[model samples]
Target: MYQLSEVESNYRRLFKDFLRNSYISGLKPLLLHSPVQYAKALWLAFLAVIVVWTHIVVVNLTLEYIDQPTEIHMAPNLVHVSNSPFPAVSVCRSNMINRGLMNNYAFKIYQHQTQYEGTFANDSRYPPLDLERLTDRLMLLTNFFLNTDGKHLDIDELGQLHNLLTSYYNGSVYSVHDILRELTPDCGDLVVRGIIYGMPVNTSQLFLKRATSSGTCCIFNYRRPSYSQSPGQRELDDAEMAALPQVVFESNSILNGIQFVLQDTHQDDYTLSFLTNTAFRLQIFPQEDYATVQSNKHGEILVDHNTIVEVPIQPKFFDSSAAVRGVTPKVRRCYFPEEGRKLLNQSYYSLDECILLCRINSMLQHCGCASSPMAGTALNVSYCTLLDLPCLMKWRGIWNGFNEYPYVEQYEEGAEDASSMSQCPLCLPNCDGVNFEITSNVAPLRKAFNATGYAHGLLKSLNNDRPLSIIKLFFKLRFAQSTQMAMVGDWVVLLNRFGGILSLMYGFSIISYIEIFYYLTGKWFVLYYRECHKQKNDSNKTELDSSSLHWNE
Candidate 1:
């Protein structure tokens, strides 16, 4: 007889009891011991099958998980107002003295008071640089006299004037007569060569200057689309609504050619300030035609979208090769790829962001006046004049590799200068998932100066003695779209559905679940524990007998 340790005895008893009650001892008999018990047990098995079958067949229902919650972010907005929002104010306070040449072939404009105008607002009193004033300033600075003796001037005389003007004005100033003669071969015989003689009009050509500071002080107002129909909302006719500003997109994705015309300008020294809302509103598909853009109780726009997503701020350049994930789609669209250009340290950017920056750089290099949308750059931003536009278009065409010149077919492919070609490749947007339409307008804010209390105060503070003749444009933007969000099938709903399936499959109810749990946890465990206890007692008695026999032997 072998003497058994207490631990070994306990394990032996446990195994013996498990064998007695387990399936080996006739599982079907134990499960079908009574009619009522068998019925309950059978119903449970059927319910489980129903749970699995319904889960697969139910195509209308789906389980979705919201990976990212929706949130509102306040970030700096970068906007482009084409056609130079900030024009240069070249005020020429000149009562000029003109000297006429023989047959009035050329004239000298001299003695003009010249100074810069307000960068934000062009004061009506301090007008911009007109043709006459510019000509006068050039003549006075270079000390060049009129060369009107003949249509064609002596080479020596022309060279002297050109050299003097170029040296004095840093080559920025050029005589209109010389330019006309060079452009037109037969201009020598023509009486009119674009320059007005004798009494000259002191007109102003405004140039947009770079911002001295970062903050743009302008008020913004938001309004629903004219087609919007809500309670207390009145639909406006086309005549009453302000027309959207014309945005010209001929060659590039960048909305770089926007023209804001100042209608009914009664004064020359009017100041214009650009206006836009502090935050951009994005509205996805809704029953209403337009987004409900009213300020909530918390002063935030009430936003409702199918799926809420988070987006990063713009103007941050990025490299294309980075493996960063979880970027929102809206943020991704802001990046534009530049093939030949690379930032010093950054490696990623949104599509539109990169293109806009490239557009600004391009305009700065070619037009000599950078768009005012960009700030804190090394180059000073200024407005491009109508005269400077032709040069801009030519340079832009050369860089973009798409010449818009009427006679571009005549030029040989490799004959054009390679240095002027665009080093960056063109970036196109993916239109598959993205589609948006915007309606906006830029209107004069002078009427608001009297209507609104804030504007009245501002008017009094800024222009107390002077009349409120500053030119200000109010910009309004409305955006709408459709977005998808991750969804999860509700657990409660699934449980109810499972219960319904079980009821249809068998006459089962909530009590069936209770019965199954009780049988598995309470009844089955109690029976097994008692059986193990009896086996343990018997094993212990046998072990004691074995120990006694061993001792006796």
Candidate 2:
């Protein structure tokens, strides 16, 4: 420490000597002796400040200028999936009554259930109604009344039984007889699937919950539908047909708000056939060092990857964040590649693939499984079970940029699930690379009933006594597809090296102002401090001499 302080002291002395010499030999001796020279020096200093100010303004303006020229051209027609950076499908549940019931049930169980009841419910997460399992004695008693009884129960008898069973439910019991008689099934042969491709928000799990009677048993039947495609074979009445659930994609909706509803029907044998096709086109720069450009005889330079492209200045929006937060710009601005980070990656993936990969990897990490809607026989990934849903939802909430507490408990680092979805190098998306424009047309599919077709044979073989119902829903989402070689990209080039260096005369550069500021202001304070110290010492000496003469007299 002592040596370091000594070195610093030596450097300070050297700097002081240099400053003193410059003032004494150069400007001070010349300017102080001559008022004309001093005025000239003052005038030059004032002018230098103005020049520096002008340079600062020029730099700010130049930063906003379009230095590079960009050529916009539509490449060959491409075919791809609809899951561009974001393809959201919002599904409104047609079954409002069932939805209300389920919402109430979920809330009641979650809110009022004891720890033991919660554990029991978790253990009895079975299909249809994920309720707590009854003990053997209770099960046997239910079986004796429901299935083992020799006599078929009348409506009155069933109502009485329901009352007995739900005595502890505080008058919230649903009548089995009334539900059976009143509930109308949806249209037969209407299979549906709504798959969200680009964003990580699970459209499957988001079911619309309408507020109804808080404690009524009517809320007991609602089950949140997962995004899925199922065969719809149950025949529906006129009201059910009109109220058929439909998947919607509104232009104003965001990715996280996407939703999907699965139809609920009674017939276990009913079958639904749903078909979906998606594609996307991406415009990007070719990664190769050299690209071929065609030009006409008119000296028109055909632009390609290496060609300089001029784009307007604008901030890029991610996840519709600016719009959601009400921070969107009034005037739209375009950003150039040179001005910001490289948004696109030099990889073999199409834009859709890159975005989908991001979604898939996120699901794997947070949800403990891949998206069931995206995963299939071709994709060797497990579907997220009902147990893993809360965990997935919490993770997605965090990723969606919502500044709220996580709904699920935190997972321990290096846990089995955490390690399962480790850093995926391949799942990264080019955040600012390219934007996508998409359009889709959905139509109901009609099929002629063929009794002698293969459908008859399959149904006959599966169950001859009961006729099978078939519901087929067809919709195709066609995205603009481009080959690996043919990409939807434009050329980006840097235009002015120094914002027209030659246009400004006298070889004046912005760097000169920066250098002047550093030299003048950076060390000027220290020099001032030393000068003030010298003046104080001279005054103290003069005071002491005056005091000594006065005392002698």
Candidate 3:
């Protein structure tokens, strides 16, 4: 704004000069020239005021006609950090339900989450975690984490949210796994596997990751370009989002949310006939090195070790795996090649054989494999030459990934059971030969299955470990030859579903029928002998008579 004195000085000088000049220049037109200009200016000001008022009123009326909702974008904030290098770490925020009955601690939980921006983005972890187990541990140790994260989640804040989550998810008698029931259902045959695949926030190829011995840890510090759900739906009407229960995970953040498997192995390949086709929300292997890629031109089956699976990304806040212990080898003793179970089976490796071998491998991995203490020292305890020695056991009733959980094996009404479920019995209270399950995609899977045998109560124990596998239609199949075949059973179930054949009983195939009939009747040749009655007296008499006749002749 111009100072009053400066404006007044210019107006007075210019106004006085203009008035004097006009008054003298045009005698007739100079009448009241200064006052006339002032009157005109006042009229123009009134018109300008009216126009400005009209513009304000129109804008106000237009705003009243349109109701625009506030816009808010929710890009899941997944985080990961680990103290141990090999075992990655993750944390994330999740939704919690009222537990049917509300608790006083509810606000405490919410308050803890608040105090941030309007969007108090809870951390969702990408590292793997068993919801039940992690929650259980958290229930036991809550205060520790709350105190720890109090330090803050940033460099300025020295605490972490890891401890905070574990304590919040302990299972109570009323404790329900809202996440499990929603994610892993009894009737549903599915597994959700996710991986923290990295991508850039911009159009760069560099995957967002932290530096490590194995190149970079694909932690949440980097944006997951394609892993998150598609953006901009205008409304949050997704059932999964609406029904998301309180996660019993130990995290405030999560990693990439991409998945792998959607179907089992055989559905897409002939080599995997025994395997029913199914898909997992997150299909992952025990080892990350073999992260499954669409091995074919089209991204489909994940295959390795002559085994195939539906690939899935590592999900948020999930950690650990089918733990395989390290081995402490002994004399790594000298044993005959035939001593191996492969030779003992002679027919093919049974499910029991597979477990023993796999268990051995797992144990070896845990026992300081590179330099085992047992090597060249304790021969008997460290290395057993015979796998089938009297004491050497064939563990049965062990679980497999084949069957869903909570299904306990029951007795088949009329069928005579084997002497024992497995060749080698297991300890009581533990699943031995009687309770066996195939949980992974292993080679020669059919070689280990019974053509016509299944565990009745298998799910009873499986519920303690894995979810179901088969889809609904697999069991609903009716073969044209079902009448001839007689009894049809759920051979191999996937994600707790029955569809494909994991095994077949003595199916009346041409070869099998021939093999059975050969032994029933003497179809080939059978040698028989009958003792001839000794006719000693008749022989002697006949001889003598012949001699006499010869002499007479």
Candidate 4:
């Protein structure tokens, strides 16, 4: 009983010393007064509120740090440069196939079908084809190769068409890419003339062929490798990189920008008139990045015939700092180019490219082939023919829903079913890249031609009766806004925030926290050791006393 009492007294003394010396604001006042005093009770109540509020705030801060560790904000200053690299201009014909070539091919196919029917009069293998229906089916097949909108057939209809097409076309699968390339108007025929910075450029020699969702489009000032290039041959040489086009910041006039006179050769085809627009679709993007129909779909501008469209662009560059890059990709919500290359095994990485590749991978896994419009050939995957159209159409929902980098709300909503859904979480936004924001204004081509001081001589070489569309792309400002990713909730920042809250509530510093921890744990450990030693000495003395009694007896 005495030993137990002594232990209780020691514990009380230790606790009293802690309360008296504590740096906490209300603790000392509460310790000095009697428990019955109102002041002591008020101090206790006030300290409880402070502790609860501080705990709530600290917990919220911790949760915020865990959920969103970084933030994207506009830079303090605009980046002004003497020379900005010109953006790549991709021009796609709304009507992808040439009307005249399609008619000629359809006529030839109709003749072949007639001859086959006559030769195999009773043969069940060869189905008789109606000329008009054959033409419509041919157009539908070509539509699958291009990014034509709102012309989808049912799976059974597509399968039957594919079977008929395979049986009629020499018992072999027709290559859609080859046929589209053959029927589509050449870039030289479509892009009649090109000019940059008021100087005439060769439309044939300057433009390179790039396959987009809109079939094959001609690209200008694009420095990246074509999608058809093999993975091993995708890298650019030093000479090629050095020779990339660069333009000085000139006036925002239409004459100071890249200009193209586009001709719509397939405008007269009424069969596909409703399915497509009678205009040229333009996509303007960073010259260093690959341009795809999916990536640049939102930025596409359509110029109607006899209209001159002026597009003034402002470029914004986004970069991630070293502090942000030090965080994991999930926390930062972006990937450095090198990190993307390593993860995706691509020569370059962009959000669009990543999404495109993800879709292609999903298609390859499900259908055992990829559509020709996608970059599956680079991976040695076979292109899906007309026969695979049914399979491809069946999984269209899964393909369309395969989002790589979703927004915060989207991610949270889908977090529960993320494993089951077709999502690519690894494909985040590129940490360093450029984006162009464009504003377009359209004027009548005749009006621009009728006005005085238009001396480009575009009128001299072209007939006024033909439908011609003009597109101009230029920078409207010399300076660009930069957005940067910054570390907002790193360990150091979290610790500082937590310390500030504690200090505000309890007047506690790091030393005060350390002192409390020492008293709570370390001092208890020392007391426990001293108590064990005292008991042990008592036990030894008892043994010695018993031994002396035995010897005396």
Which candidate number has the best lDDT?
4
TM-score to true structure, per model? 0.23, 0.28, 0.16, 0.77
- For each candidate, the alpha-carbon lDDT, in order, equals 0.30, 0.30, 0.24, 0.68
Model 2 steric clash total: 45
Supply candidate 4's per-residue lDDT for 405: 27
Per-residue accuracy of model 3 over 1-553 as CA lDDT, tens digit each: 4345544555454444443533122222333446565664665466456545644653553343222111112224433312111211111101111121122233434444443312212334322233332333223211111111111113211112232322344311111112211211111122222232221122111111211111111221221121111123212213332332221222212222221211222222211111233222222111111111111101222233212232222222211111101111111111122333333343323333333333334334433121111121111223221111111111211221122111234334442332222322320111111111112322321111333432332112222122233211000111111001111111121212211111121112334335435433332212111111223556788999999999999
What tens-digit string does per-residue lDDT give for candidate 4 at 281-384?
A: 78777675556544432376778888989898877788988888778888777789899898878677777677767767877898888776555235667778
- The clash count of every prediction, one per candidate, is 31, 45, 111, 0
Off by over 4 Å in 4: 1-13, 34-39, 59-83, 111-126, 143-173, 209-211, 224-253, 273-279, 288-290, 293-298, 322-325, 401-422, 444-457, 460-466, 481-490, 525-553
Error of 2 at 144 (Å): 35
> Residue 46 of candidate 3: its Cα lDDT?
62
Over 4 Å off in model 1, which ranges?
1-166, 169-353, 356-393, 396-456, 461-553
True-vs-predicted CA distance for residue 342, candidate 1, Å: 4.8
Give the winner by TM-score: 1 or 2. Answer: 2
| lDDT (Cα, tens digit) per residue for candidate 1, span 357-376 | 45556677777764221212
What lDDT score is found at residue 84 in candidate 2? 33
